[model samples]
Target: MTTLHQEHTAHDHEHGPACGHTPVPHGDHVDYAHDGHLHRAHAGHYDECEQGGHVAHDGHGHAHGRDCGHDSVPHGDHVDYLHDGHRHAAHDGHWDDH
Candidate 1:
């Protein structure tokens, strides 16, 4: 005698503003939050990923580290810094299993 088993998996294809390939949910020129994320703010401005979303200005800074005073995006294990018209990425010498 023999037995058989089957398995199945599901995947989600949702995309966000960062994807840069999809249109904004409202289908108009929405305000990109000062932090880099887009959310509902003005009729043509989107809100932030959190709250009080503002237009994504050229020098507002990172979305995650906006309150931290850093002008770059943090990519998990490392931090990216942008200043003086230059950009750099550095690791804090720490790693996690996650």
Candidate 2:
């Protein structure tokens, strides 16, 4: 008889200000959760201003075409955010793989 074991490892990344802009957690932002890790929001757009302050777009009427110096990661088919130093993934609404 043969047996096999599967091991899952979780990667923890630091969370801090990105591009000199501090991320404020809101209720309207999208949640990114994957592999039992919950990261920052996906729709949160932060832009660096000339005054050295961050302007949050809140994924509303503001467009995300300009280079705002936000930390983002291309995961599989979509783009996620890097809160602080941690990469966040969008939730797929399925827990079978867990």
Candidate 3:
């Protein structure tokens, strides 16, 4: 997928451990999950987080889909499940943590 350069404009609040937003450990930097979207701090602004590659979710047992009881978030193309403070998406044959 060609991820766009998206920035969350007009956002005044800062994101960190004390910001009350859930901090997710993305590749190198951290992304804060607010509402249902992931935001990453950029140059004086925040951008919608889009991970470069898939990070396998090892040992995942739960299957996320319709009627899975978890909140389904509309990601780029597929759906991501809001699971335990993070997001999960079905990959090749496993799951990926977003």
Q: How many Å off is the CA of 40 in candidate 1?
A: 23
> Candidate 2: where is the Cα deviation over 4 Å?
1-7, 10-59, 82-98
Model 3 C-alpha lDDT versus the unseen true structure: 0.78
Best by TM-score: 3
TM-score of each: 0.21, 0.23, 0.58
As a TM-score, model 1 comes out at: 0.21
Instruction: Report the lDDT tens digits of candidate 1 across residue range 1-98.
Output: 11112111221222346744323233233322232332333333233322222222344333434464535444334544443333234323321110
Could you list the CA RMSD of all candidates, in the order they appear?
Answer: 16.8, 16.0, 5.0
Clashing pairs in 2: 16-84
lDDT of 1: 0.32
Best by lDDT: 3
Give one digit per residue, the lDDT tens place, for model 2 in 48-94.
11112223323232222226455554444654454433333344331
- Weakest 10 consecutive residues, lDDT, candidate 2? 45-54
Scored by lDDT, model 2 comes in at: 0.32
